[model samples]
Target chain A: MSFIEKLKNAWVSNNSLLCIGLDPDTEKFPDLFKTMAKPEAVFAFNKAIIDATHDLVCAYKPQIAYFSAEAAETSLEQTIAYIKTQYPHIPVILDAKRGDIGSTAQKYAAEAFERYQADAVTVNPYLGLDSITPFTAYRERGTILLCRTSNSGAADLQDLSVDGIPLYQKVAITARDHWNSHNNCLLVVGATWPEQMAAIRQLVGDMPFLVPGVGAQGGDVNAMVKAGKTADGNGLIISSSRAVLYASNGDDFAQAARAVALSLRQQINVARA
Target chain B: MSFIEKLKNAWVSNNSLLCIGLDPDTEKFPDLFKTMAKPEAVFAFNKAIIDATHDLVCAYKPQIAYFSAEAAETSLEQTIAYIKTQYPHIPVILDAKRGDIGSTAQKYAAEAFERYQADAVTVNPYLGLDSITPFTAYRERGTILLCRTSNSGAADLQDLSVDGIPLYQKVAITARDHWNSHNNCLLVVGATWPEQMAAIRQLVGDMPFLVPGVGAQGGDVNAMVKAGKTADGNGLIISSSRAVLYASNGDDFAQAARAVALSLRQQINVARA
Candidate 1:
């Protein structure tokens, strides 16, 4: 099934738009995990969180840096495999943000889809169409492009005006008009910028957005949903990483994570109405 | 020692600006490597290339995609360890091109410097300074920022005019004035666009450029050197991967690679003079 279909199915089945970001920082782990190796601790924590909150999330987003930082790619592989096998309806988005020249990009595409088996992958659009095409060529998988990022410095380049339009809008237009030939393209319009998200929504027309920055980053959940939601109120995959993952640093961590995920999902559904 | 000092030392010791990119594609491996596992094959090939041409180049760059795609991170780790161990003077630049929000960027920084032990790492500038600060925080390690990439579609966003100056020039200006406080910052100015390279050189005076696209991507050596060379003729690290790597798909592959590296180094020197 195509990534969009998987997303839609997941959204309907789970009645949630919350994408739990599995960014395991071992330093932030609970006391019980202090003795285990970093990778094992990450995997154990993620499994518990998944088992507790699978039905409350539409997708699972795993940031590659956390695993790779500790040389924990094996745990990452196992994490995705477990998600795919146990929560088969939920799509897995690999937040890699990879961008390179054509030949190198093809290898990254293979890395994201073939090696990691992610249903969708986030990529940087700095290298333009040829770099994006390699990922989009996997017509069934989703290729999420960065438009207006959530960071304070995103304005350093993204907000630069080209002619009369801003650069991020240009990125949005290009991704919408040119790069989405396979209908597998999406944009990362950070919830931190609600107004920009609205503008991007207008430019892309129902192309689902992977909206990050809503939790620990302090992006307003209601404002983002109101600004970025499509007619069906299901166009945004609002992601929360640290806020939910580290809700409690004790043995109740999984329960705390599930509680946060449930509250976010409910808040989102309320905003949808 | 700082990465810039390491780079300069290697440049003087080797009397060359050429950097060999160890992007090991198993499909392109010579017949002798076909029977081995992908990771082993990649490590063996990279070891041969490093052994053959270590004396002929300023630095060695191992593109992470080639290893990560095949779940060969072990080989990549081993390759960098081997370079640092056997050839202590030569700097290893990890061409990762990573960029993200501040929190996640920290993890990526750790991945590159701590896990892989890369002397320097390439990063994307689209996310701005805060995203870059985590990498630059390692005041001793080099943080190479992407300015004008060598890809055909680089102009898509890079050429956009911001207040009459191009975006790439703005990037060059930012990297020079703001990001170089520790003197560990470098710019990636592609050899393909010599005019742009010259312009960037004018913007960021004498800041060393990690120049890619010389051999395999059809960038002219003399044109790039003329455009990008500093007053000392030593501000560029010109990289070539495929041309020197797969120079001959036979048992004499290592010999062929060394020959190509020698020739390219000679050409760059002639251009420098």
Candidate 2:
């Protein structure tokens, strides 16, 4: 199925647009798992989180760095396997933000799609068409290009005006005009900037946005949904990382996460309506 | 030793400012190695090339995409190991251009520095200060920020203006003022645009530059040195990939690569003088 259709199906079936970000900061993980002496503890913790919130979210974004940083390749492979087998329907967006020259990008595309088997992946578009083409080449997967980010320093370069348009606007247009020819492109607009989100929504039309910065980052979900949602009310995938994943660092962590995910989903639905 | 001091020593010791780019295109490998297997062949070729050119250039820049695209983690690891072990004095710049959030970036920093053991790595500063801080946090390694790239589409954003300052100039100044507080930052200016290089040089003062766009990309090295070199003539690490590594596709490929590296180094020395 196409990425959009799959996303819509997942959203409707799960009755949620919230994407649980599995950043898995080792320092933030429960002490029990930290002292487990093996990487399996990390995967076991992730499994519990997925089990608790799988029904409450449309997608799961596993930030690749967390896994790769631990030098836990096996854990990464197993976690991906579990997500694909156990969740089945929930799309996985590997938050890799990878970009390189054409030939190199092909390898990354293969790694994310073929090896990890993610439904979508985040990409950096600074290298231009060649860097983005390899990811978009995979017709079945979604490619989320970084546009206006939520970080305090985003204005350092993204706010500059190219020709007559801000750099982010130009990125949106290029993503819309050139890269999305395959209809698999998405824009990553931080929920922190609703005005930019609204403007980019106008430039990008009906394309889906993987919007981060909603919860712990203090982005207003209602404002973001108002600015980011498609006319059909299916364009936004609002993600919350620490606020949802670590709602409680104690034993009720999984339940706390589920509550957070459920509340965000309901909030998104209300805002969409 | 500080990254800048190491670079200075390499420059004087090698008597060459040229940085040999290790962008090993699988298709461009000599026919002899093609039959050896996928990544093994790639590594074998890289080892041979590095062995031949180690003394000819001051630094070796491995464009991460080429090795990464092949799903060849072993080869990538081996290639980096080979460079670090064989040429301890020469710096290795992993051209990954990675940038992300704070937590994620910490992992990337570990991957590039702790795992690959590169002397420096290229970064995309689109996400702002938090994205770049993790890399610069490692005070011992150099973090080269993408100021102006060598691609045709660079103008899509890099040339944009903000508050009367060109985007690239703003990025250069930002890197100099904000990110350089650790004193471990560098800028990436494409050798393709000499005028921009000159303008950025004036903006950034004396920080070292990892220039790529010589050779196959058609960047003018002489013009680039004229515009990009520091007043003391110690701030450029001009890189040529396709023109050097793929100089010939025969058994003597390594020798051909060494010859090109020598010539480029000679050219850079003469231009600076």
Give me the displacement of residue B90 in model 1, in angstroms. 0.5
The residue-by-residue lDDT of candidate 1 on A179-273, one tens digit each, is 89999999998888889999888888899999889789999998899999999889989999999999999999999999999999999999998
TM-score of predicted chain A against the true chain A, for each candidate: 0.99, 0.97
Error of 1 at B114 (Å): 0.4
Q: Please compute DockQ, using alpha carbons, for every candidate against the native two-chain complex.
A: 0.87, 0.50
lDDT of 2 at A71: 61
RMSD to native, candidate 2: 2.4
Model 2 misses residue B76 by how many Å? 3.0
lDDT of 1 by residue, B97-162 (tens): 999999899999999999999999999988998999999999999999999999988888888888
TM-score of chain B of each: 0.99, 0.98
**Global lDDT of each candidate:** 0.93, 0.85
Tens-digit lDDT track of model 2 for A1-273 = 867788999989988889988877767877668777456777887888999998888888888877766666567678878988987888889898887656567877877888778889999988788778888888999999999988887876788777778889989998888878899999899999899999999998898999988899999989889999888888888889999878888888899988988899999999999
